[model samples]
Target: MIDTRRLRTLRAVADHRTVTAAAAALHLTPSAVSQQLVALEHEVGHRLLERDGRGVRLTAVGRILLGHTNEVLAQLERAGADIAAYTAGTAGEVKVASFATAIGLVVAPAMDTLRDKEPGIQVRVLDAEGDQSLTMVLDGAVDVAVAVEYRGAPGEDDLRLFRIPLYSEPFDIVLPRDHPLAAVPDHDGEAAPAPERDAEMPPTPEHDARTAPVDTSPASTHDPRALPVDTPPTPERDTRTLPVDTPPTPERDTRTLPVDTPPTSERGTRTLSVADLSGEIWIGPYPGNPCHDVIALACEHAGFTPEFAHSSDDFSAVVALAAAGAGVAMVPRLALRGTDLSGVVIRPVPGPKRRVFAAVRRGAERHPLLIPLLHALQDAATALRQAPSM
Candidate 1:
């Protein structure tokens, strides 16, 4: 009998194309990954891998086994789902993996809905990028993955996954508050984020000087990755703290759009287009992030490639860099929440929305723990749809 563990190792090897990468994903040493592959080869009586330049490639037989491996793993998921359904495990824990932006965008709201509706069910969330989360879902490392569309991943119609649409959000341009396009009249230089969610930047002379700090919030979450960005508080800025406990609402828009009062001068007439930004220094998501792909493709489609001068996956850092004139950035609307946007301006752009979705193994949606969770996620997405974004 083929060891499923070895089969999973083989699948990881195939997916990452390197022993080092596969081992890192599996939390094993490269020597151990190599040993397992050797053991599996001995058991199957065929050469499963070969060297190519600096990397490894699957042998023909290895590819054939991978096909079976997918089916086998998927069937195992089906069995687990059916068993959970049979046992009526509705109150069991559901593990979720999601990108940081999606966590703020939809998952946090979903968790709230689940908590109110199904008090007994437990939900655990892990922050990961789209590609990493998708792999976690496939490997049974997590019950659900909230992610953006990534290259070379299974699609909606793929036989081994069940996808639930979450939300589609546009990428808004982040420009310095002093940019030429921001010279509009009437409205004061207010940040584009919703008023209730605005974070006060306590004068961080140290944090401010860095074009892009590792983290950018003095009131940062307990997440270890979020370092403190504190500077001495200034007297000129309105130091009043925004209410933290108020729930979000669509009717409470504080943005002073030209339509409300009308722009008097020709200063507010400039419009935004991808082609209009061809020569600007771009601040973008780090490489391998799904948002990076969106920005890169949008620029390419616009007939020019942007030269990214600063990069960060954290939306706060990206906005901070943009605020400091490092470059302009493209950020999803939801991600702008809780970020310091005091020195930034937003000009809405078109198309190329970053669509978020919930994914499970092809047949695992039937799992009792997953049913309420999926419904809760969809419900949260519906609420987000009803809410307005700038």
Candidate 2:
């Protein structure tokens, strides 16, 4: 067996044309380089070099061995490069579990970015609820889970998983386009029509303030937190396991109520209190969905209990119902961005917001395959924050 280290020394000596020069290149003494060449000749049973005056020159057999050494060294360099790239998280398939609209707003955009930036990474997306994605990550079923800040998700300090907060989005109220509040002045507390926007176009904060997503950008001056974006004001949720069950919040009365009469104080505003809607019918998410607890909790905090008269996990369906005048619905602003709002109006309050984040197993956050994907997901989230809802 030939020693690779000796072969490298032989190559360096050949190129440098002298053992002393090769020693300098290899950071070794001239005597050390000579010893390695001698060891190489012994390994192959050939006289690899001979003294040609003051300098050393390769023998016929030495030339033959040098050629093979060149090939071997080239391959070794190639192997080194490939291993480096593999460890850098620049190439591989990453499985991601996310809800649908996030697939559109965050996942899809992230996919485009990955395609351009790290084509070696293939991202497989699963359409899942926030809770489902959280479980998938913990069970090692997926490389990452893009989930909402729901009731059962692991906390940032949870030992079982690592969480990366990507962005926060406000929940918007869905109302029939003709709903009296739609005619009330917008969030500026003045009567005005919001500028229309296509789902693909970026939206301004002024429009989102009326009935869409609030800009959560670091550069944005709008203070979304100033509004109550969470229910229960300041409650702690246990996050050690999926589907955490706490004390039951009082069930909201979801029965049909006549909202036919516009408020006598029909002054338009950007924010609404859950108490104000206690008398109106409500459409909410079903129990298994991540958004369910948030909606229930937010209302409970506002001194009222609200429930789902109509429950569905699909925000599009929830919006459709609200458009049909079935009932009012609470929707994450991102979910509303891509849905048809022809007959619906969103009512945004200074209240509850859903936090979007990416999760990976305890130590997997640093996995090469996950690094780029996580970055792409985060960038997508930041872009979504700048985008307004319908």
Candidate 3:
């Protein structure tokens, strides 16, 4: 019989594309990973990997074996889930991996619910990006993962995993409060009507933008006024003046703006198109982040590439950068919830929406911890859907 551990090592090598990376991810030495691969090949009586310049590539037999390995691993996962269900104990530790925002918007709330309802079950949360989280789930390093759909993410019907969709959220353009594009002009030259704000509430404080700490309390009932564009400008304020020409300071001009990009004009309306942001400097996620690809694709569709002046993996930091007048940003709506918007103006842009999902190794969907956890996520998503947008 093929050793499951060796098969796992093979999968890791294939997924990471390098033995060194695979070893790191598996928390094993490079020699150990190589030894496992050698053992796997001997057991199967086939050479599974071949040197491809600096890296190794899977042989034809290796690809065929991998397909079977995925099936066997998935079956093993299902068998474990079935046994756990049959044993009927609610006590177990479930490790969940997710991006920063989902931890705030979904996982944290679900954990709160689970704590109240099933104290016996312990949940461990790890902050990870979509692709990394999914890989962790497949590797059994995590019991489940909360991930977003991206260009290279696994399809919904992938046999090796089960995906339970949670929610879909559109990206919003965040601008500085003092930005010329923050408000639209009224028909008679007065400011456009502002979205209603709760006068009794105080402004949320600007916290460190790098971390999104989970708030266990229910979402605040008090809704802030929608993008406030109603404040009339003074006589000296020309609503049409663009901030783009503000001299590029060392801190602000991190990257050169695309040559063909147009300059921002004060002439646009409240409703924004992707094309309208062509000239603006952007604050975005670093390369390989799912949001980074979404932003890039959205810009490509709109006819220009975003000129990223600042890059951060943290959505909070991205928003903070925009609020500080560094650049505009496209942020996921869920990330914006419960965030401080004191100096920010959020407006909808026609672009890609992120689809969030709960992923597990195939057949683990019905595990006791996962079932209730899934329900809690659904409840949170429903509540957010019903609640008014920030």
* All models, RMSD in angstroms: 14.7, 23.0, 16.4
How well does candidate 2 score on lDDT at residue 91?
Answer: 74
* Residue-wise C-alpha lDDT for candidate 2, range 56-114, written one tens digit per residue: 88999988887887567545544543455566547778899998877887789999998
Model 1 Cα lDDT, one tens digit per residue, 267-369: 2222367887889999988779988988888999999999998878888999889889888888875677667776876655665557677888765765667
Models 1 onward score TM values of: 0.73, 0.59, 0.77
- Model with the higher TM-score, candidate 1 or 2: 1
Predicted structure with the largest TM-score when compared to the true one: 3
Report, for every candidate in turn, its global Cα lDDT versus the true structure: 0.67, 0.64, 0.69
Per the 3 Å backbone cut-off, how many clashing residue pairs does candidate 2 have? 14
**Candidate 2: minimum summed lDDT over ten consecutive residues — where?**
250-259
lDDT of 3 at 310: 95
Worst 10 residues of 1 by lDDT: 208-217
Question: Candidate 1 versus the native: TM-score?
Answer: 0.73
Model 1, residue 64: displacement in angstroms?
1.8
Report the candidate with higher lDDT, 2 versus 3: 3
Q: What TM-score does candidate 2 get on C-alpha atoms? A: 0.59
Decreasing lDDT order of the candidates? 3, 1, 2
Candidate 1 error regions (>4 Å): 28-32, 183-270, 338-342, 388-390
lDDT of 3 by residue, 1-390 (tens): 889999889988988889998998889999999999999999999999998877798999999999998889876765676678679678888899998888887789889999998898899999998488998997779988999888889886576787665666667678887777676553346543322222111122332111121222342221111111114434544221111213223222111111111112221214467787898999999888988899899999989999998999888888789878999998875577666766676655544667787888766764666767766766665554444333
